[model samples]
Target: MQKISPCLWFRNEAEEAVDFYVSIFPNAKKGEVLRSGESGPGPAGSVVLVNFELFGQSFQALNGNSDETFNNSVSLSVDCKDQAEVDHYWEKLIDGRGKGLACSWLKDRYGVAWQIVPELLPRLLIDPDKAKAARVMAAMMKMVKIDVATIEEAARG
Candidate 1:
């Protein structure tokens, strides 16, 4: 169990969100489900919260009847090894459900934003060469998911 886990509040799609998330990440699973009270805020037998894990990170999906509030302010960043990994996740997660933004950011079907970043990007950019970093940044700015090969090529150029 992680020390700190993010709890996502959904209108009424906690299970659906957990299922979709688990399908995207390799090490993801639905943990536990919290049922609603007999006569509380939610009806009995309804799911109030669901514990889920994605890539070793714990997360809880709350199915509370409230306003849907999800933005790009706080996004889950996935460290990918190469372009193939990045592309795989991008295609699976996006799935024509959410909008894709440049610079390795995209919103899932539930409006949750995620940033698919390459593992090699930081090392290549932080090589104590500001010019090379700037070039790589420029190339990365035009991409939805940071491609390691493209960033490496840009840094060399």
Candidate 2:
């Protein structure tokens, strides 16, 4: 049991977002779904909250029923083990439903931002060799999705 989990806020799109997320992650499982009561916050029987697990991490989403939106300030970061892993997640997350941006950043259909980063990225960036680290950073900055080979090549220079 994790001490704390992320609570996502959405405006009447909690279920849809959860569904989309579950579809993308192979290690995902759908959990309990709670609906609004007759007392009427939303229409009775409408989904108010949903619980699920993604890659063994628990998440809860609420139908906030507000105009508020998700911004880049908070984004889920996936540390991919390799280029293939990075590519897999980047394409899967986008897949015409999302838009990829600079430096492995992307926004899914629900406007939730994600970072499909290679695990090697941070390691290379923090290397004792400042010149190689700077090269890796330069290469990564111009990339839409993180490329492990490019990062490795930069680190070698």
Q: In lDDT terms, which candidate is top?
A: 2
Encode model 1's per-residue lDDT on 1-157: one tens digit a residue.
4688899999999988998888878878899998878886688888889999887778999987889688988998888888899888888889988878879899988898888888888787687889998998889878876778778889889
Q: Name the runs in model 1 displaced over 4 angstroms.
A: none
Model 1 clash pairs? 104-144
* Candidate 1 accuracy as lDDT: 0.86
TM-score: which candidate is best?
Answer: 2
RMSD of each: 1.3, 1.0
Q: What C-alpha lDDT does candidate 2 achieve relative to the native structure?
A: 0.91
Worst 10 residues of 1 by lDDT: 141-150
